[model samples]
Target: MLDAPSSSPRLALVSEDPLARGALARALSDQAEAWTVVAAGTQEELEAARGEPPDVVLWDTGLRLEEGAAPDLGAPVLALVADEAAGELALGAGARGLLFRDVAPGMLGAALHAVARGLTVFEPGLSHVRAAPRSTAPSGAPGPDTLTPREREVLGLLAEGLSNKAIADRLAISEHTAKFHVNAVLAKLGVQRRTEAVVRAARMGLVTL
Candidate 1:
């Protein structure tokens, strides 16, 4: 009952364990009819599914990326990790949202809905996402650099490794308009390259990865 439209808001369900994958799939399948899922047991399957351009992916953080793979789906990626540390690792690795593996089945839908709308999700108490990093700031570093709340939303998609084109699609802006925000981000971070900016912005607590 799923159509593979190149522009549809399809979802890719990714997990290594059959039971976990099946369970997550069942949880997502319960959402409204527009949400489609492509089950992927491996990163290879994940990347292949991305060619169809799903709007969001429900990923288990344990899936390994092939060397030189972008290391994540270019679309919104919601990671189901084992703990807050695992969530941090996934975020640092370019995931856009994190949920505990034991997230309430209802929460699973809410989190996916949020991620698809280009919003971040954090489990409670585990919700350290809004706070700028607390680790001691590196000498001469600007930890806790704050962005206008608007820029924060832009940066959230940037952390996902999306080209301005992809980000514009998610945020409903023209590519030229998105490029303007990106240039603004580059100037603010004093960095080149999307990955470098994300690493540094997150490291310095300027932005939550």
Candidate 2:
């Protein structure tokens, strides 16, 4: 399917588990017919399947790479991880997007297509790992030190693992406004994902988790 140029984008699914590799391939073929899907059960199969390279590589967390360096493959990568911490590791390994292992089929297809189009996505509900270093605000740490009172509230709610809708209901704010506050909190905390913001808050002694 990857041999020639065509309208549909080519994608490679890499996983050690035969079931996972098969399921993802079936989902892409069934839900995302616009994509030409290929499956690889091992690294050797993955390398062999890459004749000209596909538009994207959806790889399982089992794959590892040195920090700050990407896979030699020319295509962008979307990693499947067990949790947000694993997701962060994958990103550091140069994956452009992350999908949790239990993601729904529709989301899996959509995430793949979006990453193929050059977007970096982290699945909702997967936040930063708490094992990150603690923050030391010596009367001044520009990033986490700058969160406003409202943003701090949002961060607290985020730490509670509340979705935007739940946060809005609790605070009696519109969902759009809740989303805005959440994004603002993330920006001030210097974290990319919601869970990361919560972790940062805990590290900074800003939230009692």
* Candidate with maximal lDDT: 2
Looking at candidate 2, what is the lDDT of residue 201? 81
lDDT of 1: 0.65
Off by over 4 Å in 2: 1-6, 32-34, 48-50, 62-71, 127-209
TM-score, every prediction: 0.51, 0.52
Q: Per-residue lDDT tens digits of candidate 1, residues 1-209?
A: 12223443667776657787887777766756356674466554565555666678887754432111122566788887776666666675467777788788777777777787788888785678532232222455444443544466778889887888998799776554476567666656667877887888888766675
Relative to the true structure, candidate 2 has a C-alpha RMSD (angstroms) of: 14.7
lDDT of each: 0.65, 0.69
